[model samples]
Target chain A: MNRPKEIFMMTFPLILLLGVLSCLYLESCSAKKEIQLIDSEPYPIEIPKGFPDIKIPEGNELTKARVALGKKLFFDPILSVDSSLSCGSCHLQKNAFTDLRTTSIGVEGRVGPRNTPSLVNVAFNPYFFFEGGSPSLEAQSLGPIETFHEMDFNAALLTKRLAADEHYQKMAQEAYGMEMKLFVIVSALASFERTLISANSPYDRAINGDSSAMTPAQWRGKELFFSDHTNCASCHPAPLFTNFSIENIGLEKEYQDKGRYRVTLKNEDIGKFKTPGLRNIGLTAPYMHDGSLESLDMVIEHFNVGGLGHKNQHPLIRPLDLSDHQKKDLIAFLHALTDQDVLLKPEWAP
Target chain B: MKTIKVILMALIGLTMLTLQGCDNSGCTDPDSLNFDPEATEDNGKCDFPNLTVNFSYSVDGQELTKGTTYTINGTAISFSDVQFYVFNPRVAKDGVMEATGETHFISFDNRSIEFEDLTAGHKHMLMFGLGVDSTTNATIQPSDSDLADGAALGPQNPSMHWGWDNGYIFLKMDGMVDTDGDNVPNAGMEFHIGKNINFNTIALEIHTDALEDEVEVTVDVDFAKAFTGIDLSKDYITHTGDFPALANTVINNMKTAFAKK
Candidate 1:
């Protein structure tokens, strides 16, 4: 009994010293760990070669938690009033983020006016919508959400719905350091959309030193595309494949949709629409603002006929006198722009 | 040790009691709307008397009723809907102007509106905007300061906002007119005036006193003045951007139609 007491007396001091040292080390480590858990980490994006830097709006940086939350919201149907349609419902990854419809059908089967534009590489777009009404991607999301025939939902109500979910509440604190708000919803979606960069096409590969990436017909058609006879490069220049010009391409004699005139209230802006990038054109047809042209041949023929001679037609939209063989080559070149990787990328899918 | 523990508990209880005694701050003005009877100290956020405003529509000095036939520019017309937005309301008393930075949706369905924070004195000038201002019209999303769920500047059922252009339709007058020479008013006539450039302000000279409790003010809006230079037979429909000439004439007429009663 005396021997055991002596052993306990000697071991007690050592144990007490170890206990003091452990408390100091653990307190410091726990402080650092807590900060790491609460704060969002940076999400790195691979900017395409030869493209201008993505201009992320100030106060909203790309973070891993924010992008994940945005992706979840993009696929959620709770944004709609009826909870039946989501942003992903109209923008499918299989069709390069386009719905493959003449015009998208919204909540309650309401047919919208404008064709759904492809969201592939939308980060590079200077402005949003075919009419170019919204200047930033963050503001552009509000258009569809509040439209009467689209989602038909209110932003004020969206906040309440998101706040009620514990997962969303926790994620909101992690991503934005606050509860789910209207600012959080818009900014988070914009961050995820900015990550949708598509520059791995065969044409991109060929230009980036892969000699055998493109076919002979695609090469020949590329030369004609940049030539003065086609004049396609004037409006659709390289890198982004668009110069971001809002112009009247003379698609109609009397337009029902006034296009940018609705925003500017100017007579000259009637029938004018923003020129979209041609990165995934093959996957995103029927073409034009109204999705009137059904096929690539129809689009080529429309340009060949000089666009039905509307008064507001672009001065450079005169007929492209190309042979049938050349038309086939142009179609082949457009197909070469299709990036197969973007369609099947698991990271982009739900 | 037990005696010392009792002293600490008593000291903590005393501190809590002292903190509770310091919370005597609240609205103390008897004339204010949110006057707290139990409050001993006054906070600056005391609401005052409210001045209520209601509109009356007239055509040719006659009361205009919905679905009632009226003649304007030799065309028989009947209005089915008449609605507008009133924003940035201000009342001036003795050269000291106070503005309620609020927007309200007014219609034949709901015609009464109230402006609080008025002093108990006669107001000489009453001014309010006919449409949304440039900054508010830029986007459909209302500012955080605005009543998020209130009818003022919030999303409506029929939707006062134009989602395509991301602006609000300030004034909407929809009805039917006898355009095909038929006696019955069957042809649709829609006049939607909006856009930031078309935002107009109407200032009226009113002789009304806001009592310590509340006061009522009536403002007349003549429907005939809206058709002063407009011919409903040929120029019937305008969504502001599609037919700017007719819209410009109607807005000009609307500006002169308001009078305090």
Candidate 2:
């Protein structure tokens, strides 16, 4: 019995020592093995040669943490004053970042005056807003945030709310190295938005010398678009599909909206409005600044009629006289602007 | 032994926390981040050219003297607030036409010179008459602060932009015109002229040679001559009501003013 006790005392310490060592080893191994919360593959952003480099603001550089936070904020109703709406409320990913409604509903269900434009490739735009009023993406993000009908939240309050949350505070600091400010919040969102480039489309492939990219109908449509019969390329030009210039396409004799003229206050500029890019236009419906047209066919019909019979209408907006096949073909060509890669980005979703 | 064990556990925990914190530091994932190789280089400053335009006018048979106060057909007129715009000026080297620069609103409330030398030649153009071309107008956004505030034009100067409607007032001629029955001091007449559409932009290409050596281009605008095409007495008893009607009537006659004289 004495011998048994001695053996127990000796073996117990040895076993205890082994157990402790194993536990420490396992803990060290666990510490070394990090849980990779983000995917290894980078988001694709192809900048063509000779194009001006896009300037992403420092402190809010594009990162997984920042993008992930922005994505959550975009989908979260917390950004809205009433917790009733989100950016994604109007800019649904499936609908090419545009709402299906003629006009978007804002906080408290107030309808907006203008239609929601697409977010795809918005980073490439040199100017923002319907009339090209906002000069940069950072400046543009502030519009809907404080608009009475949109988020309806003061930017200062937004910054405060973000800073108050421990989770957001940590993420913001990690991404921006400090607590969130209004500029940093918007910059983060803008940084996330800048990554929303759409390059891989059927039209892009065709332009890049891929013969099999476009269908025969789309090919015919492409020809018609560039042809003088349609003359669509005059305004909706190639590459970016927008010259970033405004025009008064004769919507009315005297526009109550005044389009761009509201900004310039020049007489000749009365009815002018910015010419939107045609890329992925098929996905963004209810066309025009007011979302007057419902479909691509209706838009074609409107253009065929040489726009509204207003005197201020653009002289370039002559009658197209496109046939049914031509219209269909034109629509097919527009569909070629859809970038599947942009639409299906898993990180873009909530 | 127990004290030593506690110290060792504390050290392990500290090391783990330190490693965890360090892992996230400088851990910019290349796949998630987009780095522009072009962005490495700095974009140079925006260089705008210098635009200069000079204006002179003749009254009756003689060249109007600089700083001479005179009345054109009984309108007390001074070239005090004269401004200029080039509808689109072409840069000789770029091969691309320069956009309409900011309006150089002249600030001369008191001083007078018949010949006005408008500086910033690369910025201003001598557009014919009062209105900008429709093509240029169509692209201009009213919301553009550069255009709306008249950054080129001096602030608070009365220009023909209709605050009610969305177009520009086509003609703006502000000077004292002798009227039959008007009580307002200065008896100023404003010819705010604009058209929604069907209005033609009279193209007047003032040659570079005309502007060379900063020579003054004479533009003789007779306030009474604006009414030569229309009898205002028959159109309206007074210039008190409905300026648009008056503007419409005056613009119809003003078309003759740009007949390649």
Best by TM-score: 1
lDDT of 2 by residue, B1-261 (tens): 999999999999999999766542331322112222333333332222233333333344344443445554433443333232323323222232443343323223321122222222332223433455565444442323233322432112343333223334444554443345342224444444554442443334444432323343333433344455444323322111133456555655554443111
DockQ numbers for every candidate?
0.20, 0.02
Considering every candidate listed, which one attains the maximal DockQ? 1
Residue pairs in collision within model 1: none
Which segments of candidate 2 are over 4 A away from where they belong?
Answer: A1-44, A48-52, A57-61, B1-261
| Model 1 misplaced regions, further than 4 Å | A1-39, B1-84, B92-98, B101-121, B139-160, B172-192, B210-214, B220-239, B242-253
Instruction: Evaluate model 2: give its TM-score.
Output: 0.51
Candidate 1: deviation at residue A253, Å? 1.5
What's model 2's lDDT at A155?
56
